[model samples]
Structures are given as structure tokens and as C-alpha cells.
Target: MSLPPKTALITVGATAPFPALISASLAPAFLSTLSSLGYTHLLIQHGLTPTNFGGTPSGQSLLSSLTNLSTTSPLKITAFDFTPNLSSEIATSDLIISHAGSGSILEALRHVKRLVVVPNEDLMDNHQKELAGELEAQGYLIEGRVDNLPEAIKKAERATFKHFPRSGSEVFGRIVEEELGFEAEG
Candidate 1:
């Protein structure tokens, strides 16, 4: 008997202030390609994007588009505005495609999930690209673009994710004491 295919989660945060360009780019053609590459299910958290087309897509409209896309592709697709159980979603997914928000990056890294980051370059003074680039350089994630999402996904299958160091309050407190001469009472 053959095992089931892996699942992928793509999240574009509502607080991101811009649509997820990569997801938008993937809709018409690449979804089928992803399916052929062995992904069984794809869950897209569209956040507050107004439409799923080329611009800001409303959640309903995006879902409609995704539904249509799913009909044409073998991959089972689900698109939602947002999910309250984001941590649960993250934990369940085998691969993650996300906007380059710090929280998303950290969570995926913490879970050691295979990650692909598509930073929203539309935002004013967006630093997400830089962060994603740095992490990609360290082999922790793949930095992707709207125009080349399939290539990114193909590359991510073989990409290595390095273990990220965890920092805690005690470590931060020590740094503060040394750098700013501030001490916390134990």
C-alpha cells in the first residue's frame, strides 16, 4: 500500500497590509504543477486580501477562485480568510509557504518545517525581504517571488533547514545587564 501525499500550508497574514503576491501568482497554473509534484492537500490562509486574482481579493472571491482552481487541479485546495487555530495549522502542515513576517518565520523554524517565504514587496519600507534573504542564505528557508513560485517549491524539496538557536528571557536579561547596565531582581 502507498502512503498518502504530504500537505502544504500557505499563509498570508491579515496584518501584513498587502496581498500575498506569491499565492496570487500560483493560482491559475502552478497549483496543478504542485499537485503533480505529490502534494495532496493545500490550505491557503488568504488573510484579508480583497480578491484572489491580481489585486487585493476579498475572501469570498478568493475562495471562489481557489474552488475553480481546485476543480482543474488534482490537489485538494482550501482557502480561508483566517484561522483562529493557526498553531494547529502550522503543526499539521508538512510544508509551509508564507509571507516573510517575523512571527511566521519563527514559528515555522521552531517547528523545523520546510518553509518558503514570499515577502510583500509592496509595503512601505518592508524589511521582510531582507529577513527572508538572510534566512535563505543560512539554508533555513527559500526566498521566492511571485513569478517563480514553482521553481521555489521544487527547490525547497531539497533545501536544508538549519536548526535555529532559541533565546529566552534569561539570555536577553544578561545581554541587557551587560549592554545597558540594567539588572533584574531574581
Candidate 2:
């Protein structure tokens, strides 16, 4: 695949009310790996705005860190205050690192881009981790923690997500089925 030399990844908040835990940070590792891959472009916006709507502290923190790293790294990084027209963003990016948030994941999948999922443990109730794990299992996402974050990011960058097409259909179907109390027939 003739992917881009650089990429941008974004992590969003969880949907489940509890708030994801900010336990293990994965952005740095992600960025470093991209750098190692000879990527000249990388952007990470941590806390973005309201999902379908606009920004929170975590979102702010993510933005801050992304911007900070961009300023320091040799590459130029672009950080969004919140969700800034993600369709366009991901379509142009080669990779995206996002939380298990429904909105974020869906957007990435829509673009058929590779994604590294770092579940939000701060706001959510330990659900994102499971979600991330499941995605990893399904070959739709690359989930990691501080322990092997670097390795995970590298894996993500190198991974060829053949299941890109299924990502959106499955996830979207499940969400709709669950909401409508209907069994999703995949």
C-alpha cells in the first residue's frame, strides 16, 4: 500500500459515563514510532470537542501535549481544539490513534485508515480497555499501554488492517442493533 510518509492520530473520550482512566499514556510512544518510521507529519489531539458537537480538559490536555510535542519534534504537528471536521482529517491521514470512543472510532473506520486505539481509562468505567482489546483481537485497532506502547505503535504503523471495510459495518451495525433492541446479523 502506498500510504503517506506521515500521519495524524486523534484520541477521543469514552461514551460510557464513568470517564476513562488516564492510566497509560500512549501518544508519546505513538509519535516516536511514527518518527522512527521516517514520517515527517504527525498530529495528535488528545481531548477534542463534543463528539457530534465540540472540548474538555482531557481533550485540552491531549491538544496541549500534541501541540507541545509538535513544537519540539522535527516534524510539524497539527492539533485540533476538538473534533474539527474529522472526515477530512482522517481521509488525508495515513494513521489515526484514538480512544474507544464510539464517535472517534467510527470516523476513523469510515476513512479506512489504520488506527491505534488507546482506551480511555479515566472517564469510562474500565470499558474502553475491553473495547480496545476486542478491536485488537478483530484486527481493527492497535491497543497498548505504557509497558509496550512503543512496540504497539510500531506494530500499528506496520500492520495492514485488511479488515478496514468490516470495521465500520460491524461496529455500526452492532451499535444500531443494540440501540434498537434487534439482533445484528453479520
Badly placed stretches (over 4 Å) of model 1 are: 20-26, 51-60, 168-186
Lowest lDDT 10-mer window, candidate 2?
A: 17-26
Tens digits of per-residue lDDT, candidate 1, 1-186, equal: 866778898888768644556355445556755776788888878777665455523344555666666667777877777878887888999889889887787778777788989888887655677767767876778998877778898889888778666762344234334444456677
Pick the TM-score winner: 1
Q: Which ranges of candidate 2 are over 4 A from the true structure?
A: 1-5, 13-30, 48-71, 170-172, 175-186
- Model 2: lDDT of residue 121: 59
Q: Give the whole-model CA lDDT for all candidates, comma-separated.
A: 0.73, 0.59
TM-score for every candidate vs. truth?
Answer: 0.80, 0.67
Clashing pairs in 1: 49-57, 50-56, 50-57, 50-58, 51-56, 51-57, 51-58
Q: Which lDDT tens digits does candidate 2 get at residues 1-186?
A: 765567655555423321131213324554566677766775545453432221322354444544556567756776444464667777888777676666777778777788877665565356667666766777777886545656776898778774556446676556545544577566
